[model samples]
Structures are given as structure tokens and as C-alpha cells.
Target: MSDIAAPRSSSRARNLKGGGRNRSGQTNFELYSWLFMRLSGLALVVLVLGHLFTNLMLGDGINGLDFAFVAGKWASPLWQVWDLLMLWLAMLHGTNGMRTIINDYAEKDQTRFWLKALLLTASIVIVVLGTLVIFTFDPCLDPHSTLSVCQ
Candidate 1:
């Protein structure tokens, strides 16, 4: 063996200068976040595929899409729930990914904090608005409506 001692292990090297173990008392938030990203990503794939197939492959296809088409689709509670889940999951999944990016690239604590705050605010607003639109959509908003649902 050489006279020089081997380098310290990474975990030991990160210890406090006073030889004390550096325990930050942090919880498993990162672990849960990672798990959520994976689960939501899988869920989003299924949801998006279902949504695309339903909207594009069924009925008259893309040519049939219009305000009336949307009205008909949203009239069903099943479609409403499907779209709502898609909206929420997509927003949350995207937000989580952005949060990870912010944590990785943002150098200053204040910048990170503000970026996260903005992200949260924007996400909440989008989710709330999307949910409201999905649930409270008025398909018969037109004053002159002869559609069966309007009757």
C-alpha cells in the first residue's frame, strides 16, 4: 500500500466540520414527490390517449369538432370527469417537473422561492379554472338554441 491514505467516503466527507453527523431532520418529501411524478406520468399517458381516441377517432372525426360537438361531449358526466381528471393530473405533473427543474437550476434561495411561488399560483389558477369549466359548462348559452338539451 502507498504511504498516502485513501480518500474519505462521500458520506463521511459531508459530515460537519466538528466531526458531528450532519442530520438536517428533513422528511421524505423528495421521495414522495418522485413517486408522484412517476404515477402521474403513467396516468397522464392513459388519459391523453383515451382523450385523443375519443375526440379524434369516434363519430365524424376532426371534421365534426365544433362548439356543438363540445356541448354534446360535455353533456355527459363521464366525459366531464374524464376531462377533469386529465386536467388536474396534467397540471400537477407538469408543475412537479417544473419544480424539480427550479430546484436543480435556481442558484439563489430567494429566486427559487419566488419561482416556486409563481409556479404554485399559476398552477392553482389553471386547475381551478379548468375544473370550473369542466363542471359548470353551459352548453346552451346561446340565446337562440333549438338543441334538444336546451328544451
Candidate 2:
């Protein structure tokens, strides 16, 4: 018999890698991140599709989308919360994906660190601004605004 092991089947090859066994000092960050990507992607699909349907198919369709329509929609607490959730999930999901890409492509530790730092800073800025806009939105910015919400 040859000293080298025989070629294994796909299942056997997969079993070679550690499966469900927790090794000391090994964090499960990657696993959790992978899971989060899947869950957030599913949620985003639902949120985006619902938003599109509400905006394009309901009411006056595409023509109804004006400043007043936006003001009216944002005036509701429910729509505010919905938009807030969508903004947060989309930002986080996209950031996580970009982080993964940086990790995979960047060769040096310093390069990875800088790239991730930039990504994190940008993500934080966007999420904070978006959340603030969603919660603090005022449809009646102008005193003479004709929007019904303004009245």
C-alpha cells in the first residue's frame, strides 16, 4: 500500500474539517457573521419589496410620489419605524459584506485595519444620520407649507 492516504469522497472530505466542535481560544465570530448575513438578507428582501409595493402599486402609483406624498408617509409612526428598520438592516448588511471582502482581499494587517476602520466610520455616519432623519423628520419645515401634515 502507498504511504499517501486514498482519495476520499466529498462527504469524507467535508468531515475532515472540524464540525460543531468548539476549540479553545477559537471565536465563532465568522459563524455568527455568516448567519447574520443570511438572516438580514432575507429580512431586507421582505422590507424592500413591501416598500416598493406600497410606493408603486398602491395609492396613485408612480405619479402619486411627490413631496407631499413623502411628507404624508413619514408623518405616520408606523412608516417611520419601518423605514428606520430598513435603513439599519441595509447598512449593517452591506458593511458586513464589505468587511468580509476586505478581510479576504487585503494582504497586510495594517491595510485590513485601515480599510475596516474607514468602512466602520462610514457605516456609523450613515446609520446615525438615517436614524436621526427617520425619527426627527418634520414634514412642516416651512411655516407656509401646504402639506396636510403641516396643517
Candidate 3:
């Protein structure tokens, strides 16, 4: 039998030459968002694992986790800031990933715009509320927990 060459993928060949070029110049937003996703994901790996290790492994494990534990953690400004960073990074990372999905799948321009707007608004609210809770939390609020150290 005569040797034959493998068939090539014409679609991929065309795409390699910028076959999908759009009607406008490319924006850097997607590039930056993609980079952010990778970097934030990496940082989250460390932050989340460290948090788990401290709260669940370094101490009495899960049994040590309670309202008082949380209060005690938050009482230290360092831990509070760490939690705040985690909250912001997670929300932003997840929201950006969702935005990429919506941009990919949404058909109508108006629909995409509205959905993204809502997502942004909700993210903002949650981030603000979570940050406020972290900084403004009072461990002495509960009457039954008067023996707590914060009281």
C-alpha cells in the first residue's frame, strides 16, 4: 500500500490564522481577567488551606470551631484582614468566572447586559456586607456568652 498523509483539521488551520477575527480591536479585559483567575486561584489555594489548618488541624480540630472561635479569630485584626481578603478575592474570582460564562452563552445584548449588571450589584452588596461584619462584629453582643473573653 502507498503511504498516505494524515488528514488535517481545516477549521483549526483557519482559526490559527485569525479566522475568528471580529469587527473591532481586541480588548485587554479578557486577558487581564484570565490572568486574575489563575493568580487568584493560586492565592486562594494557600489562604484557604492555611485557614483550614489553623482552625481545624492546629487546634482541637472541628470540635474547637464555634461562635467563640470565630469571635476570637475576628478579635485579632490580622485574622480579620485575612478573612476580608479571602472574601473579596473569592467573590471577585467567582463573579469574573461567571461573567465569562455569561458572555460566552448569552445571545441578546440586552439580556447579557442586564444579567451582568445584576451580578455586579449583588457581588458588591455581599462584599460590602461581609467586610462590615468582619470589622464591626461585637463578640459581647450575646447575653448568654457574658463569660466570653471579649465581654
- The CA lDDT of each predicted structure is 0.87, 0.87, 0.85
Each model's TM-score? 0.78, 0.78, 0.73
Q: Residue by residue across 1-151, what tens digits does model 2's lDDT show?
A: 6786666664455554557423443457789889999999999999999999999999889999987887888878888888999999999899999998999999999999999999999999999999998777788888999876666
How big is the positional error of residue 78 in model 1, measured in Å on the Cα after superposition? 1.2
Worst 10-residue lDDT window, candidate 2: 16-25
lDDT tens digits, residue span 1-151, model 3: 4676545665445545564442243445677888999999999998889898998898799999888888889879889888999999999999998899999999999999999999999999999999899878888778767545844
Q: Which segments of candidate 3 are over 4 A away from where they belong? A: 1-26, 58-63
* Candidate 2: residue pairs that collide: none
| Model 1 Cα lDDT, one tens digit per residue, 99-144 | 9999999999999999999999999999999998887899889978
In candidate 2 the C-alpha lDDT for residue 60 amounts to 88
* lDDT, residue 116, candidate 2: 98
* Worst lDDT 10-window in candidate 3: 19-28
